[model samples]
Target: MRTAIVGSVLLVAGAVAAVTGILPLSDLVELWDRVWPILLFVLAITVVTELAAAAGLFTVIAQHTARWGRGRAWTLWLLVALLATVSTIFLSLDTTAVLLTPVVVVLARHSGLDPLPFALTTVWLANTGSLLLPVSNLTNLLAQHAMGQPSPFEFAALMAAPAVVAIVVPLAVIFVLYRRSLLARYRTGEGVAVDDPVLFRWSAGVVAALVPLLVSGLPVWIPAVAAALVLGAVFLVRRRGVLRVGLLPWQLIVLASGLFLFIEALHAVGLGTVLAAVSGEGESPLALLRLAVTGMVGANAIDNLPAYLALEPSAESPLRLAALLIGVNAGPLITPWASLATLLWHQRLTSMGVEIRWGRYMLLGVVVAPLTVVLSTLALAAFA
Candidate 1:
């Protein structure tokens, strides 16, 4: 497969680079200074959040809504999406997906609705809403910290228009596609009982974990430490039973952090400068459109986080960063590997016996991705 060939080529290239001393141990050491702490923090938060989520906290909330009426299916979907969005505000996308995927799968099976729409909506909302906080997305956080810019809240205010478009348009599409199924599931009786004790304990843990983010000017370590303490307490109380609760997917966290460092490597190696030269300095509509298209294409080929990080060093203005993020996020809707969130959706759907082919997903992506990027870019330019 093409993926295999590309992976092989990258491996060989990396080996050669290391042997030739093109990327020296010294260079790697310097890169670690810039990357390792962020990677560790992201991984830690991801693990703790996943543990809390798997404790059946959100599932319990979904079950309560399912008891209300059939319409609660949509409400349940919205709640998952909202939590996913909120989670991305403090945790990375990998963390959000790992934390929410299991809960979404169980809720969909219980409600008799396909999990695809719910999972996809959650992923999309996570990408959009995370743009609200500096710590929301790794790429955003890196850019802000690197540039010594203000907090993410300030950037979020500037990006409000695109954020609204990103959240609203896809939701409309999801509702239209699944309206009948949603209605049918709502009419069916509520499926199962939930464990109240586990739910309350997890809810308390989530609150305690989030306390650090609520107070401004707190060190990022505060939330990281709180999450660890809360999860440790929960595990102690649950004892051996805690192992039954899912842990975060450490592989995804590793992949995300590795890609972030790799892209930062690319930037250090002057790829961004080369890209800037090729892009030229212009603010014309055609130039902006070209940049957006290029961003989307790069994202599909490599992953949004890496694409954003690689582009960060070359971006000449805030508008460029905004455009790149919008386009990169939009393009990932097309491919399974494009975004970990989409991959998470696919995994959840598979677990529930729903298989969506790449071709079918592409059908949706072809229609929505371009429109979303174009609209998002225009909104960013107009507002920023």
Candidate 2:
């Protein structure tokens, strides 16, 4: 609701700016031209995941994962980390945040383990693990556009090194911070019963098929929309009551639209120049670090998407662009609003009765964000 209100205000402000010529009409059109496909992908993929969850697909997987853990908390934690990574890389960070957070939290509780470790793993990996593919993060989509539409494999290869570092660094920090919790053993719970077995089977099948198509070098929205429509039709037949306006992710669409316009308006007024000056110039390791740090600061201050847009012009070289990606995609771990995924993850956790103290979260993030960003950036400079 708060997000909707803020998005409404920003959307109105951007409209006013365009009407008054504070932001050029041509520029607005150009921005939409670039972003519409990305937004479409976001909406479609979100719907697909939401419908899948509603069909008990994620719960089934979580229970299976619990069984696979063999009663070791550490093993279960690692499995959840792997699941979160796979979800973030293939489905997008928002999917991991919105869908996987609850699954892992519930999985932890059902196993009689501390939910905090599993909860933190999902949210952290949702941001950091998102660096591997264009579909993993919205900023990655924008970067892919800037990079002339590289093949999904090509994009993944370029980011593979840093993406590994980003995932590992967070996992290492998590293991150390929650070593006691993770080292304990727990009893495996029984599998969750599917209320609609046919719906679950179809939804699971659609998701399995959709995952490969997402990375098949086609525009991502094609597969996402197809999967969403397939699941929508299944739900309509098997569980019409679950199909509602709420599944559309209207707030996110509105928020992203408003953000793109609002940020473009700021850029039109010379935010770009200021950001470029701050980000500096060069593909040197130090220069890349500077740009990455600048992006990290901007992301923590505002949000990752806006930070990426603000600093993108300065990242002309491929290496520098990788660095910027490292910062914006892997660096937004501190504040709740640092990335939309974090916000969504927090919301999911709260709804499931998990309470996280913001001060401790911030303190932990302050330590982990810099380490992850710096190590990941250096890994890019060294490897990519």
Candidate 3:
């Protein structure tokens, strides 16, 4: 409800800007051309994941992951990390934060392990691991369009170096910080119950197939829409009660839409020049570092999405763009509002009676986020 109200306010502000000539109608058309497909992909993918959750797909995976741990706490944490990484890489960070967090938290509790490490892994990996693919983050999708709609393989290749680094750094930090708890053993939990066996199998199959299709380079939305439609039909036939208007992710769509318009308006009014002045120029290591640091600061100060949009004009080349992505994607670990995924992860944890100390989270992030961003940006430069 708070998110919906925020979205409504932003949407109204964007509409007012357009009406008052703060944002030209001509640019509005161009923005729509670029963003409509991205919005559609978000809508479709959200529906797909929501229905899949309703069918118990992620719960089954968490159960299997816990069983695979065989009573070793470290192994279980690693498995959860792997699960969060894969979920973020394929399903988007929001999905990992929103859907996978609760499942893993419960998995850890059921197995008699502290849930903090597992919870931290999901939120951190959701941001860091999201550097891998276009479908992995909304920022990646925007960057894909900016980079001429590169094939998924091509995009992955460009990001491969930093993606590995972004994932490894926080993981290293988490391991060191939580070694005491992580190294301890836990009991193996029983299998999770599924209310409907047939629905679970079908949803699992659909998601399994959807993963490859997402990276098939078929304009993204096509595969996502098809998956959503299939899942919607399945739910309608098997359990119509789960199919509702709430599945559409209207709040997110509105928020993103307003962000697009407002950011574009800011750019039109010379936000680009100001950002470029601060971000500097060239692809030298120092120059890239400046832009990346600028993005990191902006992301932590505001939110990553707007920060990325505000600084994008300064990222004139592929390397600089990569640097900016490193900052905004891997560097948003410090604040609750730095990324929506972080907030969503917190909400899930709070709902599940998992308490997280924000002060501790911020302190750890202060150490981790910069280290990850700097190391990852250097990796990007080296790859370039």
Candidate 3, residue 245: Cα displacement in angstroms equals 4.7
User: What is the C-alpha lDDT profile of model 3 across 232-326, one tens digit per residue?
Assistant: 88888999998888667676666667667777777778887898899999999889889888999888876788888888878877778888998
Indicate the residue-level lDDT of 203 in model 2. 86
Sorting all predicted structures by lDDT, with the top scorer first, yields: 2, 3, 1
* Native-referenced Cα lDDT, model 2: 0.86
- Per-residue lDDT of model 1, residues 1-384, tens digit only: 343344455545544555666666776676667656655555555556445545666566556555654456677767766777666666656556656666666667667777778776776665555555566665666666655696566777866777777767777777888887655545445444545566457655664656456334564556665776677677667654654323443454455445544554565568677766655555555566667666776677677766766666556676666666676665567766677666555554554476678898878876777777777777777776
lDDT of 3 at 125: 97
lDDT for position 23 in model 1: 62
lDDT of 2 by residue, 1-384 (tens): 877788888899999999999999999998988788877886887788778878888777778888989999999999999899998998789777876886897788788999998999999999999998888888888898888889889998889999999999999999999999899999987766889889989988998898788767688789889999999998888889988987776776787678778888988999989999999999878988999999999898778988898898999966788899999988888887788788767766765689999788999999999999999988988987
Residue 19 of candidate 3: its Cα lDDT? Answer: 92
- Note each model's CA RMSD in angstroms: 4.2, 2.4, 3.0
Q: Which pairs clash inside model 3?
A: none
Candidate 3 least-lDDT 10 residues: 247-256
Q: What is the C-alpha local distance difference test score of candidate 3?
A: 0.83
TM-score of each: 0.79, 0.90, 0.86
Prediction 2 TM-score vs. true: 0.90
